[model samples]
Target: MNRSTVDVTFVVGYLAVAIGLLVARSNPATTYEPSIYTGTPMITWVTFAVALAIAVGMALTCRGREQALGIGLGAITVTGIVSLPVIRNYRFAGMGDALTHLGWTRDIVAGELAPHELFYPAIHSIASVFHYAGGIPIERALLFSMVITFVPFLIFVPLVVRELTGPSMAIGAAAIVSWMVLPINNIATHMGVHTNSNALFLAPVVIFAVFAYLRRRATIERLPLGLSPFSLLVVLSGIGLLLIHPQQMVNIVVLLGAISSVQYIVRRRSDDHPILDHPTMYAHTIVLGVVFGLWALSNERFRDALLILVVGLLTEDVGSGAEVDQRGSSLTEIGGSLGELFVTMFLESAIISLIVGVFVLLVWLGRTRLAPEAKSLVNYLAISMVPLTGMFVVYFVGTPTMAFRQLGFIAVLLTILAGVAISRGVGTLSNYVSRPGGTAIAALGLSICLVLGLMTVFASPMIYDPGQHVTDQKFSGYESGFEHADEDLPHAGMGYDPYRYDHGLNGVEGDGTLSGATVDSGTVDSEAFEDGDYADAYNGIDYYFIMTQYDITRELGVYQELYYSEDTLEEFERSPEANKVISNDEFRMYVVSSTE
Candidate 1:
């Protein structure tokens, strides 16, 4: 094959691997796939094969700069949106704020007209309206929202980076950083089924707003497609962010504002006026803030917090424990962590990414010559650090865990900037090298960065194990033949307790005979099923093993009821209202709606 063919093939292969990394966590068995890596073993293999095929296609179709970039982004967008159907079984929006989304649907179905959680009033309220329109289920409506929101990053990130840097750098940077940011492993694994997933949609919109605002103020070219309606678009995006997660929305605004202010400061010092002085900047900011603020007022919590922060009476706490109340953390902490969460997303996931990003950025800074425009870009990036630092200060006052989670967006932006820096570095070095030498040098640098990034993506999935959490209320604990009840508990921060519940025998049962079985060799469908006895007769009843409840509430993560037979189980006539003795293991066991 010719050299061009070889390069194209390599690109295709690399992209395939990238796609695998993106969906590696999706579970196939469940309607809401959750994280494949976290649930069914078969799902991982399926996702791997699918990702590989897509990557190969990307490589084969590689053409000129713009087309190649478009293809790569299009792949992510298509896959992300297509994956929505995977979340079919999700209920109550699937999890966290998703509950609010589902709650919206419930109210609509019942013909009630009110909101649920304060955190996501807008999304929930809008979802209610959609349900009233009468076509999709609550789950489908949220999934649609997720898919629609996911598409822009595919288009906007590359476009923005290209505008700021060059086409080649833009695409490469977009790919690397996106790999870190988009499917934040921890969130996808344990939490995406919850309301937290909806907040992620706002990220791309926020980035797009910055891109549009920057272009409006900085670029001399004719207005982009969204520029004419920039203020409206930004307002909408802001409202979305606010409705989904106000704290995260705050982080985006603060970070963007900080960057703009920095650019303005540096430019003014240099006797220049880049976009900071433009009345349009302030106009966009005010309108966006107002629209979202009005929506936030619907939630009393939001209104109170906003009043406290805006009035200067309350600043959010920074370094409290994992169980520290959400009100303790500032708006900046919530938002900033979303930006920075990529690194510690799940142990080593962020480490490899951070190394690659830092390496690339240093290389670029050392080797590349910065045009005045690039310098301005650098200045803006530097200014972004200010609010990030402020977030750190907030961390000191409240929860360190808050800082940990907020790093997702920051990591992406940082990694992308680093990649751009590397490209510029290569370009700069080329200026000094003879033609042949420059080509060789640039090629070498690109290959190294790409290799490192791919390695990080592939290895990230390994950092977490798929074992279920077992505890007292859920199961009877490790003594009951369930493995990993005590392992990997999130003792320090507000993280998931990766455990599963097993039936335990009772103190509360009147029949006092517990019967159970170990089914399937880890596969409930297989021959590993066997009967066993529990010390307490009431163990035949259904239960839950909540890792967070046990650890945080310090209560039994397992619970069982007394039973005499399958049809006639004994009940405690006056067993007191269920209460968690320990706040950490605050879980309780109850009859399940269904087991299949």
Candidate 2:
């Protein structure tokens, strides 16, 4: 067979073996642990690691289109590894956010909530469509939408990277390695069903279009396809971004506005400015900006939320050196382990940061060789980081605006830059060594290991596994508990979300139970059992929930500092003030007698 044919066959065989093994071994966790590998079985992750290693090896080694295909295959498989558990255990994964989204989706489907009623409705709106059209459950549909949003990364990342540095084997590797910044978050940019994360995924399309215009790529000549693909994508994705999460849309608006303003200035000075190639970007940017402004004003939910944020900024000591809160540490605080804290905060993100670092250094080192469009992006990223750093400082010192979430945005842009860096690194290395074959192989091997490691960290709850996708039986216990709750007295979970989503859905007229405030699981399990001490320790609440998730956190010590042991039944059974009103193993709710 020809080399291309052999490469193609290898690629196809690898993809099938990897994906098939993953599916065959993948099953929902019988007993919930934040780590799917331990919860499901050992083989699941072994297969994943093996499959990833092979894919990454080839992605770095193979040449031309075959390599690009390898990168896409590797990326899809890694995404699948992350998403499979959520799909398998669909109902109430990621604790409350998914449930809240489900509730909103349910409302949207039932005609109880209009799409515009929420600021970010594209995900829910699309999920609703998928649920109805595909005849799937609402939860699965949302999960499906979340994974589907990631599909664009495979296309746009490659496109942007290729645009910046021409094409090379490193472009393919970038696709796989870029998953480190997927942006592999548990918060706003989480791989799970987050609306802003979806918006962030589509951001490369906007960036790619901006660069495509610099190349003066032609419009489609056929009827009904008159516009350039970038222009059309800009329009559609611009609207999609606005609907999915306007926070990202606002960034695109600013990006396009800057590009547009430059074009206008260059046009006025010179009839056809060579530097600012895209003449029409100015109008598109202005239109998007106006639409964004109108959206901010018209959406009452967003407006009120913005005002609340404004109040936080106004009340905060922004000028104060951004001191971290000196609150008392919980038993789960890692006990002042600065190294672990730093690893958790920075090490997981080091891959993406390293890529951006390399990219910045390359811009200075090879400035004359870079395309004008790439140079412009470098300048923008540098200028933007000043404000971005300041905002993060303010947020760290306790501002209501969640500045950390913007890392997802920066991560998206950085992934494209990584592509350029990887290709340049390969080229530079190739030029330096006369007999570079062994060194090249070693470098590729190291690259493959990093890709595999990043995928595991980014996708699975390895480094942090306290909170996880809830098991079916465990979720069932909550549903069953809410069904038998007392209407008058208040109830609260010991950690995380407090089962308040279900309470709100049940529309129970209970007092503090519906507020979603949570207590420490340790306080629930080990506090004094004296007449009034036990009751007051639960914070005047009537019911204390000992959840499987809290137990998992308690066991893994992921994010639960104060949460106690998993077998709370023994402890609760010994308590005099607490009565085990609800229990079926996975979940237990103790009714604290107010009379005590």
Candidate 3:
């Protein structure tokens, strides 16, 4: 189809999906909670509607389909942002773990005026305003934040590629890239991974800035033009990204700049460094560094990480957090916190990356020969891998905070690469497929591949037998320091990995290693071990709820090690103070009171 036809199709498809999302969410019988609704008929219907719309718009916008596609993406980004506060108000509703934390963060940050407490203060501040202006409940605002976060990539990815490869190739690449699901990339979109939000916004802003810098420099080179607004915009975008999530913005820019610097260095050796000679590039880099540097210095964690990396020259292991141990599985881990990096990438990121890789490889192989520009595109794409590797490292080593959320820029890069690869592959195949009867065969093959893939993906949700609605079942288990409902604990102290127990039915036996310990009232101090103490002493609010879950599995030795020891344990086990043994389908909830 032609451009106009494609635009019409895109708009129409998007509208239909919007209507479906509205209707499904509007349903009185459904709460729109992800856990309860995820595999339900309502969710299925909504997914189908949304996916259909996305597919249509995507197909129509092929070959640098920026305008229509960009709007659709922007709309979603707005929606995610709006959802943030709503999720918070209805925190008890299980939208997902990510949604839960997002909701909590939104409320606490808004109420306490502690956006600074979050890893990415800027994004949270903007989100806070969005929540306040809309008069949305905290829960909904959280959800909205998630929706809006996805917008920039939708617009920026196609635009970036189009600048390099022309509209047709851009469209083809986008279509192919749109489907990949990389590891821990959700840090850009989800509430649970708030730090990623900063990264999400920053990545695109940087790209837009880079593009503008290029334009302004070209103007100066050709016509001795005055300072272009494009360069200003680039600088502003970098500032915005830094304000929102400086740490991620810095990491992303530095990683890319390092590669670019290498290119410049190589050129300098041969006396041919265009990027170095270009004042625009130089200005963009310098300004970005300064702005992002200031932002980084504002946060303790970011400041510490940076100081350790650049000034102190501390080793990665010493500076990293414990989470890094599980970022990716062994298969995908690249560098830094090798063990955890592997877990994070393989378990969380691989799906998206793998799908994109396959399609992009096809495009690359099909091209047969690469153009000089294409070769440059390939270099930039390769440079992106550094940040992607960094993401794996951070996922395992560092906390994925709102400031870190923008790290998903790697997701955008991966998507772009995949798109480029696929377009090239299809271009290559077009030659052989043009023969008599060959087009028909190729079309049939494509159809079969698509159908099979969809079937495989949808199979789990489709065949899942809906059992009796047991939403109110009592999850129970009694442990040492405290008592808890079974629903709270998961196998091996992994706590609840929502990915595994999506429906919340299966009960994993608590290992009691860090769980199932019993604390005697005399062994611990009442003031020290009190629930409020955890919050006061450790900024322990986040860990408080998680510790409560372990009460059911805590045993003598296990529970005794707790700082609060006896008094805290007694408070958990006995009560007129809300301590009681309440049993449910999976586990029992116990109210306890303690006397130190």
Best by lDDT: 2
Q: Candidate 2 residues 541-590, lDDT tens each?
A: 56554546545455446544334443443455676767776666567667
- For model 3, give the 10-residue run with minimal summed lDDT: 461-470
Ranking by TM-score: 2, 3, 1
Q: Judging by lDDT, tell me the better candidate of 2 and 3.
A: 2
Native-to-model Cα distance after best TM-score fit, residue 133 in candidate 1, in Å: 6.1
lDDT of 3: 0.43
| Clash total of candidate 2 | 1
- Please list the residue runs of candidate 1 whose C-alpha ends up more than 4 Å from where it truly belongs after superposition: 1-35, 38-66, 77-97, 114-119, 125-136, 182-197, 216-228, 263-268, 272-280, 290-298, 303-367, 415-419, 425-596
Q: Model 3 off-target regions past 4 Å?
A: 1-16, 28-119, 179-193, 215-226, 259-263, 266-280, 304-370, 384-409, 435-578, 581-590, 593-596
lDDT-wise, the better of 1 and 3 is 3
TM-score of each: 0.58, 0.84, 0.59
Error of 3 at 138 (Å): 3.4
Segments of candidate 2 deviating more than 4 angstroms: 1-5, 8-26, 86-90, 217-229, 261-274, 317-336, 361-368, 372-401, 434-465, 503-532, 539-541, 544-546, 555-569
lDDT of 2 at 437: 61
Candidates in order have lDDT scores of 0.42, 0.60, 0.43
Residue-level lDDT tens digits of model 1 in 1-596: 46587566556544654554444434333322223333434433344344434332332223365346434643463444234233323332232333334444454455544454345655555555565686776555655555554555445655556656654643553544444343343433222323344455456666666666555543444346634455556667776777666656766676657665665565567655454443334555656567656767766766665454444324433234433344334213323332333333343344434544554455347543555565555556556756866775564344443354455545545544654654554456567886446535544443344333333321122222221222233323222323422222111111232221121111111121211212111111101111112112122322222223323221111111111122221111112321122222323222111122
